[model samples]
Target: MPVNDTFGDVRITTHRDNDDLLSAGLGLRGLAGTATRFVQPASPTPEELRRRAIQSSWKGIADLGPRGGFGSVYGSIPHVPGREFTSFAYLPGARASHRVLLQVPDEFDHERRCLVVTASSGSRGIYGSIAVAGGWGLPRGCAVAYTDKAGGAGYFDPADRTGVQLDGTRVRAGSAPLEFEPQGLAADAGIAVKHAHSGDNPEADWGRHVLQAARFGLAMLDRAFPHEAPFTAQNTTIIATGLSNGGGAVLRAAGDDKDGMLAAVVAMEPNIHVRGGRSFYDYATEAALWLPAALSARQFDDVPFARVGAASPPAWMLRGAALRAHGRLTSLMPGAQAEEALAMLRAGGWTDEVLATAASSTSLDLWRAVAVAYASAYLKRDAAHMPGGFSYRLQHAAGVAGPIDAIVRAAWWADGSGVPPGTGISLDGGTDLSLDPTLPGVLTLRDLQTGHGADADQLRAAVDATAAELPREGLPILIVHGAQDGLIPVAFSSQPYVKWLRDAGRTPVFWKVPYAQHFDAFLAFADFGDRHAPLLPFGYAALDRAWAHVAQGRALPEDAAVRETRPRGAGPLTAATLSLPPN
Candidate 1:
């Protein structure tokens, strides 16, 4: 059994015994069990969908009552009306609700008759916002909705006690009701939807979310716009799309809601599900992570729960973020805390060197190497063996504490494989550990497991429940993972999902980009620089293909698998190279 048959990091031989090791090693910082509230979708009748949708409306958005309680984040921005809607998500807790900072494109076409829903991979960086504002889905001249993941949404207040809600509504003990605001898309002549909370699905809250959002959004398109397509799950096709987590979620949503609503699903650099046979690793594979403090703070809203913006500490936030991450890179080292040392650097205005490397360096090692060289540039002598006096202290203090965050975390959790799926520690969650402007350390595994009041039981539940949903038969889909994806090992979904779907007699297209990482890049780029542009066309292509198939029943090429490669030098994407089964 190859390693890819199992979880990317989990060794087939060791996974059964190392569940805790696996979780802790990945820097999950929470003791999450598999989630509950699982939905094993059989075809839901329109009446069932309608009745449930109606009930959801009454219990969901109706509680908020129109868009009255919601406030606009973008003040006086023409063409793009950026608004935030506070609603409930599916999670297990007193405060299981979430919200979306939506964009209603000025050019939204009611006549185009499509609602493009985007999932924010892990809810970090420009996760869902770009997809909505001007990225993939939004550019299609359709309405766009974006939100943070459950982990992203639930990071504040570190204690197990639920954090404060954005709208300040009293959350009851049981699962908090989902917040749905289809009418909020009123500006776009389309619809809006706030599904279950954005965290790992602890209670398996996803069952109702994707469906409800689709049904309600479509119903609104019909009832309000009238001229727009009147799409019931049966009548019209809906496209489900997302990247990483969102990518995985959309595919799961389409699988679970098979033969309904979803005309197709477009998952970009998604962590897909392949069948885990007798082992976690079907083959040897590597994983990657995107750390914080990289390029423009990844766009968080000004809300209290947000990591940046008005609520966080002013002087030390980003610096603190980098500092906090030092140990994960160095990993349980004897001494020389990067967090403390970084503080010293920040106080002296020395953070720019390492940060500049972080922004440009494609790999974490380059980031670490650059930082070490810059820190030691002032050394009196050239490289030599044991230098006792001042040199020993200086090198031990700073040079040795190089980046091991991604490495240590991946190794610890992945059965010593050294590459893990997804980021175990939360980028935003790092803020919870400290506020020291200079040092304010990132959240370490110890901090995640013990420091914060994370509920072990709840964490366990969310972890298990959030596991990728297996692809079942029934939906015509196209799953694309960037061959260049350094994060969330591609084998996670590509191999296993293909195995599962094939076993189930389902045939969805799977495409891998030769030079894309999470998102594909143009010529010559394996995966960095001018990042967003390379992926835009791929995203649009996936959706366009899915829409054509789901809505029009058009047949796609029989090429089961293909790798998209670009020219050696900078240029546009070259045609894909298809893989045919051996004769």
Candidate 2:
């Protein structure tokens, strides 16, 4: 009888002695048995072996039967002697639950191992798969039995030792509740207390809830891959990254564990600090004084005296001032020089009809007056108890105002130049202040300014800290900045961060998309112009290359292209403008 080699390299030669054949069969069966022991075993048949071989690409089994019918017959047999199987389990904890599973291969190699886990599951039925391929080919007697703990959900302090579960396949334990309190001026001025959700307490304790959820997820991972444990080295590297609120949390986690736990981090648009103090007040004061004068000057033809003694500025004027202070007023002010500002505005489509409405002198004057009003309201509601009745006062006293002002002024100048153009008033369409109409009308400009400042600071700190830990030689860091971002000026945030990283011997790439605002840039990959079109894809491609370098443990290219060669999208002002100068 002809013998065949079916299960990989395992050679099966027909033997004359029945005892020898039985012993060989027993040895193969033992190997399969060891692999399936981790999970509930499913009785295997000849048909199953054929299916397993096809799935795993084990050539040894293919030699046993006919082409198409081989798998059917192989799957029908009760025992395959040398095959593998897998299964999983879900365990619940005091605060959360977890899912654990087993992964086995036909032949066990010391270096090759398997751990099955649920990657994704939803309304669809459950499915199981291995995290890593190949079974650790261990010599028959040297294999160690997998052990771990199971689940339960509750606040288990890392320091406390209660309600802990440990088993051969999984482990579970509780952790301390997460702590969250408002930071910056919001916390310092005691506003958080007055605004507290309910009861006598002014602050909400939602951190505990979030912590419980995260811990539960961790527990699930623990149960699924019981063989793996949290990295224990004192100097082992830990990297954390996230977007928006999650980004802020990741940065906080890294900072909190800075000493030894977290080694690196990547947080995008984190919200860490609050904007409070004299700087804010100063901007309000400037807006109040400057806006009226600016608006009066803009109405050289109509509404000449509108800014002289207006009862109340128009809503559009207030929006304009707020936008200007936030480094988003490029549309209102244009031209290379102040002399050309009016002409540039007119050329961009600001008509006399638009000016004749005179709801509040000129848009500039209206903006200033509105700024003052909003500031006054904010002082009353959120900063009444502060030293100067405003957080901006302290900031001015501390000498930080100069630097901050310089940054804002530079951004404003850029906005006017059409360099980083912003959306502005038009001949036909009214101003489109990107505020949601459903929100309370009582929301003052001061609140918007304060929130925007706080969020910007947080993002800056997070990015800076994260960049500090990254290896100078790794992948290139791509920075995307919206030219017309009102909440966070691209020049102040992304530009400065990139400069700092490069100065520190790191490869940093930057792309400034025109006309694109903060939220819009994230929503789509746009082409600005022929010269700057591929900007978005360039960033993504660079990121991919960086990841490739990371996998190879090599540094990213320093001289790689950092600027785009095609137009990506319209700049902020470009999008707002109806007419364009001929090339």
Candidate 3:
């Protein structure tokens, strides 16, 4: 037999067998039937109806799992007497503590339907709160989710009207474990040989190390939050997302779990590769100066640097030698010189194979090859280190020693010619950053290009390959780019992506902001700081349009005002400035 329960404008049907409550349904059909009979008959006040709706929505959430046990223990407000439970734990490494509180509503007699709130505190902790608010124009049922300072004080509710406040708390347990490990690689072999070398070792190449770390971390989460029956049932949908490196890991996790365990994935600035693989040796040679002490020690002593160099010398071996010599001769130091060599690698035309060979190549052969390559490429005349007509000053500046210096050289080389320094490009803030989105992709690309770990062309092909795998249904895509992007050339990065979408017949809308760099637009539009400035207005306008297009399934109207660029040297205005007193 089924029993009908009504809360505000929404209604639910529940059944009980002996001491166990069977199920509670909160779909539109169920609510409509109950509303017509009970809610309409009562003709209740708007406030009363709102409260009912709030309660009803909670009832649904509480009853989401099997046996309705999830709701049974935590349902209702003011909670059931003697039915409260609190737990505390610490997060490892983070040195934080976390607390969870559960309370059930009093009006509902069923023990299964309850409200649960968990709070965490720490220097920087992740925490969220959920509440049900009912009444006035509110739907029959509504649930709002919020975070105190979780992801920096933002509201995350399906229902836009509700506001939620979250606070930070530490997890008593130590850091969750998620790491990746390579299998089949020698202890000191570079990743290039790792096609045959994949195994767990601290000396493993960077790619393998990162992969291991990610896997280990995920394992830790699984251990802490074991997939119990109730949890699994309640969590029918799991969304994995993050920013930069974290985002890439989340995407990797999603891709690995095709078993519907992860319902969706969001990756911001996914750093997955689209070109040739890079090697550890290549990376080290390119940015030798900035190479961490640990990495250098491992490269020099443990990894048989000489052998690796002989096997895979970079194209610019001569520059590497000159810089290496300059570092040893001048008080620049080995580490410093290594850093300089890295910068020179970024001027483009350098490939991953060249780097790996240089790292493993013999010193004599390596230097000789480098000298020859330099003469051919830069001097355009074969004259060893002293190419005639090439001034020593120019050579030093462009070569191993000069005004360009180590720091400048390293940054330029690392970014590559395709992504030069000061190339103004900003990432969209709509994607979550907590997950470390950029690193994984960057690391992966580096591995492909330098280590020969993966072919660059194959990696690039993966992008289109993955996109093709998505459901054929039309996807509303939002393309955001800055006209003056310096880090990622707008013409190369964003334009190509947009063209691909159009080719696939997907609806792609492009937004180009003037005078905005990668970091500026990211911070401004993402609402990272005070929201009352010039950025807030334009940011919110763009945000509103994006949300409407993505979440609400609506078309954005063209803004003629947006087309007019501000005149040169014209300072932007903000709401705060507008409210200022007369000078």
Candidate 4:
């Protein structure tokens, strides 16, 4: 049976990992797989270098934060009117010392309304973002608060890579795990506790992570502000919103809000509802997903897919040079398939000369996309700061992702297992019957490597158990997706959830943004792509409607068309301009 437990009286402590960094590396999140099975971590980044240089403190302030999340959130809350940023320590899970970095809006009335506990881009950006870009909904009667969720903060844009020197070569920016001692920062920030435990960068377990996040929200409400019923969303009463992983989390919270703590969720471009296919899946989503992996794999010294003929290729086969990237991508498939893809591109006027230059080739871009996609799906998706061993995180994900991928390939791959695994409820005694509402039809990260099938029925049960399903009652959902989303297919990510809502007899407000990709790239480009951008105004607009109903029972805009235009003459593209045709 799954562990069914609860926190007695949550104890807040300085956020710490279960093991020290050096130990963690030798432990679970440590050096992974055999020499034969390839997966590796990276050398520290420029930020990490700066952190090491800082060592201890600057005037007793923790020197570690300056390069990343520091200064503004610590000390006294900034005296900005209609806005304040602060950090708090809380126990989300029992004894789990975590920090919730927050930015409270100016319109916040601690005594009456509740601030929508949201997320900041990367570690914490939304709290300090430009509103036209969809953050800190100022002058809109909207109040906000956010947390880092983990990893100190997520990757800083362009696939979370920052260019760095490695072996005298300029490696593209990618996920670089670093450990920072927080003694000075914690004390200076006034969040230090007597029994300070330590935690480091760790792998992700959505089940545990979401539970802690949900708990964090309630704790933030009770401990950080005056205990009110919390700001509402009309019918559901309490509302939660976030982007990307944060978006997926609020939905998880709603499903697990057994005490009726939440009423609705506004999840933008969530990762759920993605299907099993890898090769023959969403072209756009896959391309964007893999780009980072191609770059990150270099840090691991991965054999390029161009050389797949050498050793049958490792699981994460991605080696991309800016020059030969297109040819490398086509070689992933055997024989005729590669020919087919190449012919398609050739027919479209993609000559060799065109393919050689990175900017000119659609094929090269696709190569970069799949590279990052594989890296993310396999090694880097839930990379965050947590209380566990690095080895455990890696193995946990691998055990789950590897086997799960196998099951997926078997059932969905055309050249896979003849017997297919159908959707929803599975017959043949293959699904885990224990649907524990909070994490229904889900497989905890630990469960990933726990069991695999020698039997067909067993594998089916394993596959069925991995999905995330929760209740829809009381929670009116407003799913806003971009029609042109390249990170997640609007069809795969949102349409299925719509089906679930309908099946439950609930009418969720599903709105699609025209010409919008996974994010507001136009706005992001204007900011020089500093952070992981939010979905276009559609999500925020939906939230406004939801809040209106909650605040004064106003009606939300009934199905509507939301525009997300990039300005003319936009090159790389920005939300300010209309998106241009493919080059």
Judged by lDDT, which candidate is best? Answer: 1
lDDT of 2 by residue, 185-225 (tens): 33223111111111111101111112222233233323434
- Candidate 2 structure lDDT: 0.26
**Per lDDT, what order, best first?**
1, 4, 2, 3
Q: Please report how far candidate 2 places residue 575 from its true position, in Å.
A: 22
Off by over 4 Å in 2: 1-219, 230-239, 244-314, 317-478, 498-516, 521-546, 557-562, 565-583
Clash count, candidate 2 = 77
Clashes in each model (backbone N, CA, C under 3 Å)?
A: 53, 77, 141, 50
Q: What local lDDT score does residue 304 receive in model 3, on the 0 to 100 scale?
A: 21
Error of 3 at 402 (Å): 41
Per-residue alpha-carbon lDDT of candidate 4 for residues 483-546, written as tens digits (9 for 90 to 100):
6454455555666766766777867677665545443422323221222223434465677666
The TM-score of predicted model 1 comes to 0.47
Off by over 4 Å in 1: 1-95, 100-112, 125-129, 132-134, 145-208, 219-231, 273-462, 468-472, 519-533, 560-564, 567-583
Off by over 4 Å in 4: 1-98, 105-107, 110-112, 120-134, 137-143, 153-237, 274-339, 342-466, 521-534, 561-583
TM values, all candidates: 0.47, 0.32, 0.30, 0.47
lDDT of 1: 0.34
The predictions' CA RMSDs to the true structure, in order, are 20.6, 22.9, 23.2, 17.5
lDDT of 3 by residue, 1-583 (tens): 0112111111121222211111122332232223212233213332222223323333321222222112222222221111111222222221111222222121332222111111111101121112111110012111111111111111111111111111111111123210111222232221111111111111112122122222222222233335522333133222332222222233334333423443223322222222133222233223332222112322334322323333222222233333334342232454544444343443432332233223333332222222222222221211112221211111134345443432222221111111111212111111123232222222332343344433444433323332212212233333344343322334434355445545667444455544332222222222211221121123223334543453356675342223443312222333333221111
Whole-model lDDT, model 3: 0.25
